[model samples]
Target chain A: MTIPIDVETKHRIVVVLLWLAALVALAVLAFIIAVVLWNGLPAVTLSFLLESPRDMGRAGGIFPMVVSTVAVTLLAVIVAAPLGVGTAIYLTEYTSETALTRVIRFGAECLAGVPSIIFGLFGFIFFVIQLGMGWSVLSGGLTLAVMILPTVMRTAEEAIRAVPESFREASFSTGASRWQTVTQVVLPSALPGIVTGVILGVGRGVGETAAVIFTAGSSLHIPTSIFSPARTMAVHFYILAREGISMRHAYGTAAVLVILILAINTAANWLMLRFQAKQG
Target chain B: MTVARREKAIERALLVSALSAVSMLALIAAFILIEGAPVMLRHGISSFLAGTRWAPTKGSFGILPMIVASVVVTLGAMVIAVPLGLSCAVFLAEIAPRRAANFLRPAIQLLAGIPSVVYGFVGILFLVPLIRENLGGPGLSVLAAVVILGVMVLPTLIGIAEDAIEAVPRTYKEGALALGCTHAQAIRRVILPAARGGIIAAVILAMGRAVGETMAVIMVIGNAAIIPCSVLDPARTLTSNIALEMGYAAGDHQKALFATGVVLFAFIMVLNSIATMRIVRGRR
Candidate 1:
C-alpha cells in the first residue's frame, strides 16, 4: 500500500501534529506539578504542619486552616447530601419527565453554572447581612452546600437511572411497592455513587475560597461553634498572596492546599472506579 | 391505607417543591437583583456599565475594565485550551491504544480535582515568573490569568470531547476506511462532523467554567481595574472584582458589587439554559 507522497500521509501528519500538541500540553502540566511539588515538598516538615500559625508567626502549621476546612466541609456535606439526594430521589423515583421536571432540571443547571463570586455576593447579602449570620462557619457551609447541590443531584440521578429496569420488574412481581423497591433495593445499589457525590461535594467545600470569603468573614482562630467566624486553607492562601506574605508560609500553604486537592481528587477517582466496577 | 397512598402524598410534595426549584433559582436572581438593584438604580445603568474608573472609595464604581478583563481572560484561555483539549480528546479517542487510554484516563481527570486556589499558586510561582521573564512584564497579568484558566479548563474540555468522540459510530470510520481513507482521514472527515454537537457542548461547558472561576483567576490576575491594551497588562475579571471588593463594602458600593454578581449570574444562567436546552433537545 506504499504510495509516493500520499495525501493520506499528509493528513496523518496533521493528526499526529494534533496528538503531539496535546501531549506537549500534558507535559507542560506535568512540569508545573513537578516544580510546585519540588518547591513545596522540601519545606513541609511535621513541625511545619503540627504547630499553629500563632507561635510568634514562626510555626507554619495550619492547625486552624486544617480544622476549619474539616469542620466547614463537614457541615456543608451534611446539609447538601440530604437535599441533593432527596431531589435526586424526587426526580428519579417520584416525578414524571413533565414540564415541571424539565423546569427543575433547568434550575439545577442554572444553579450549578452560577459563579462562585455570585454565590458569595448572595451569601453576603442574605446570610451575612440580612440573617446576620456574621461571617460564621454556618453561612460558608450553607453557601457551599447550595453550590454543590447540583453535583450531588446530577450524580445521584445518574446513579438512580443506571439501576436496571429488571430490578423494578422483579420487585413488582413479588408485590413490592415502588417506594419499597426504591428505598430498599435501588438506594442501596446507588449508595456508592451517592457517596461519590457527597465526597466530591465535600472536596469542593474544602478547596473553596471565594464563596467562603464573602460568607465566612475571614477569621483566623479556631471556631467554638458553627456560628463562629473562620477561614479555610484556600482563603489563607488567598490572604497570604494578597497580603504579600511572599516566599514564606505562602509556599507551604500552597503546598498544603495542593495536597488537599490531590487527596480529594484521588478519593473521587477511587469512588468513580468503585462505582463503575459495581455496575460491571 | 396502602403504599400507593403514601406514594401519592410523597409524589405530590416532590412535584410541588421541585417546581419551587424555579422560584429558588428566581430567588437567587431576585436576591441578587433586590440587593444589587439599589446600586444600579442609584448610579444609573450607564454609569455602572460604562463608567471607566473604578474608585469605589470616591463613589466612582465603574466596571468597564473589569468587563473587558473578563472577556480578555476568557478569550485568551479559550485560545490555549480549545486546541490542546480537543487534541487530547482526539488522542485518547482516536489515536491512543485502548489499554494506554484506560491507564491514563483517571490521571487526566485528576487534574480537574486540583483546587482552583492551588492552581492559582502554581500560576503565581510558575506562570507569573515565566511571563515576566519571557513576555517581559512585572508579574500577574492577563497572560497569567489566561495560562492558569487554560490549564484549569483542560480536563473539562478533554472529558467532554473524549465522550463525544467515543460516541461516534464505528460505521462512520468503517465507511471512510472502506473508501480508501486512513484512520486519521476517517477521523478528520466523518468522526469529527458527527461529534460536532458534543464538541460544541464541551466548549460551552468550558466557557462556563472559565466565566465562573474566581479564586484562581483572582490569585493571578493582578486585580488591576485598568483596561488591558496588551496581555502583559494587569487586569481584573468580574469574578475577581467581586471577590476582591465584597469585603469592607457597604451602601451603594456593596450594591454595585452585588450588581457585578448579577451580571455574572445572568451570563452563567444563559450558559446554563444552553446546556439544559442541548440536553433536552438532544434527548428527543
Candidate 2:
C-alpha cells in the first residue's frame, strides 16, 4: 500500500482538483448574488418601494406585494408557533418511547418531505374550495402554517432535549409540578431555540411562492383585509417574469426578495451561534 | 384540581396538539385521493398515465410526457449536482483548512436559504438567454432547468455529504496512512467507503428535492407538454403542468391535476422513505 515517489504528482493533482472544485462552488454562489444585486439594486427606489402599480405591474412599485407578503408570513407565524411548540413539548417532555410517538415523528417527517406544490393543491382544495375561505391571506397563511409546522416542531424538540436533565430533576425536587417546571424553567432555557425555529419558519413563509400562489389569489390590488386577494413578492416576480411584462421590475422584486431572505438567514445563524455559545 | 388530574389534562392537551400533524397528513392524502380518484376511474388509469397527448380542453388528459419530463430533468440535475456536490463536501470535510471550512459552511447555508423563485429569476435572465443564443431552441429548456436545479440542490448534497464524511471514524484514516497510503488515497479508499451509505442517502434526498421542485421548473422549463428529445428541448414536468393548468382548470381537468399530484406525492414518499431508511441503517 506504500506510495512511490512518483505518486507525489498524483497526490498533488488530487489536491489541486479538490481546491478547484471548492472554488467553483464558491464562485457560483458569488456570481449569483452579484448578478442579482447588480441587475436588481438600481431599479429599487423610494417610489418603487412605496407606490402602487400604474399599468399592469409595468410602471410602478411592489408596495402591495410587500404588504401581502408580510401579512401572510405574520399570520403563518401566529398560527404555526403555538402548535409546533406544543407538539415539540409533547414529544420531548410528555411522551415516552412508544409506537404512537414514532408514528407522530414519521408523520412529521412525511409532512416535511411533501412538496410545496402539493401543499398548494391541498390548500386550494381544502381551504379555498371546501372551507369557503376563498383565495386570501388566511388561506395562504394556514397552508404555510401546515408546511412549516414540522420544521418548528423538530427544532424546538431538539432545543428542549438539549436542556440538562439536572435542571428538570432540581425543579421536581423543589416541589415544582411538571407543568410549572416546563412553563417557568424549561421554556425560558429553550426560548432561543424556539425563536430560531420561528425565524426559520418565517423565512420559509416569506420565500414561498408556489404554495401561496393558489391559496392567496394573485390580485394586484392592495388588500384591505385578510380575505382580500393579494399577491406575494415571489408570485409577483413569477408573474412579471413569466409574462415578459417588465424585466426591470422583475429584477427589482427579485433583488428585494433575495435581500430579505439573506437577512433572515444571517440573523438565524447568528442567533443559533449565540445560543450554542451560551450553552457551551 | 388535584395535581395528578392537572398533569393528566396537560398531557392530554399536548398529545392532542401533537397528533394534529398526523391528522393533517391524513386529510391531505384523503382529499387528493377523493378529488383525483374519480377522474382516474372514469378516464381509466392506464390512459391517464400512458397517453402522450394532453389536450384537456378537448377532454384528452395524458401525463406521460410530463412524467418523462420530470424524470429526465431530475436525472439531468442529479448528473450535474452529485459529482460537484460530493467533491465540495470532500474538500470541506477532508481537504480544507478549518478556517476555510467554517467560512464555506455558512456561505453554503446562505445559498440554501435563497428562494427557488430567485433561482428561477436568475435562470430566466442569464441561463435561458445563454442557452437560447448558443445552444438553439428556446432559452427556457431542460438544460436551463438542469443547470439551475443542480445549483439549487448543491447545499443539500454538500451539507449531508459533509456530515457523512466527517462521521467516518478517525481510526480508518489513520490506519490507511499508517499503511503508507497518501492522504488522497486514504480518503478515496477508506473514508469514502465508510461513508458510502450516508452519501447515497444524501443523493437520494437531493433527488427527492429535484423531483418535487415546482416553481423553478415552471419558470424555466418552457412549459411545453411534449416529450423532450434533447437537453435543449423545452418540456413540462408533472409539477409545472399542475401549477400552470390548475388555476383555470375545471371539472375533469382539475381532477386530472390532482391525479398528477398523487403521482408526484407517491414518488416523493418513496424517495424520502428510502433515504431515511439508508440514513437510519448507516447510523446503526
Best-performing candidate as measured by TM-score: 2
Model 2 regions more than 4 Å off: A1-5
Highest DockQ: give the candidate number.
2
Model 1 misplaced stretches (Cα beyond 4 Å)? A1-5, A55-60, B12-23
Please give, for residues B38-156, the per-residue lDDT of candidate 1 as tens digits: 88878888998889999988999888998889888888899999988888899889888887677557667767766787788778777898888888877889989998888888888
Model 1 lDDT per residue over A1-280, tens place:
8668788678778777876866676676577567667777776788777667764233557777778888888888887787787788889887678877777888887887777787787777788878889888899888888888888888888988888888888888899877888888889999888888887787778778888988886777887899999888888877876676655676677777777767877787788788889888
lDDT, candidates in the order shown: 0.80, 0.90
lDDT of 1: 0.80
Error of 1 at B223 (Å): 1.9
Error of 2 at B159 (Å): 1.8
Candidate 2 pairs with clashing backbones: none
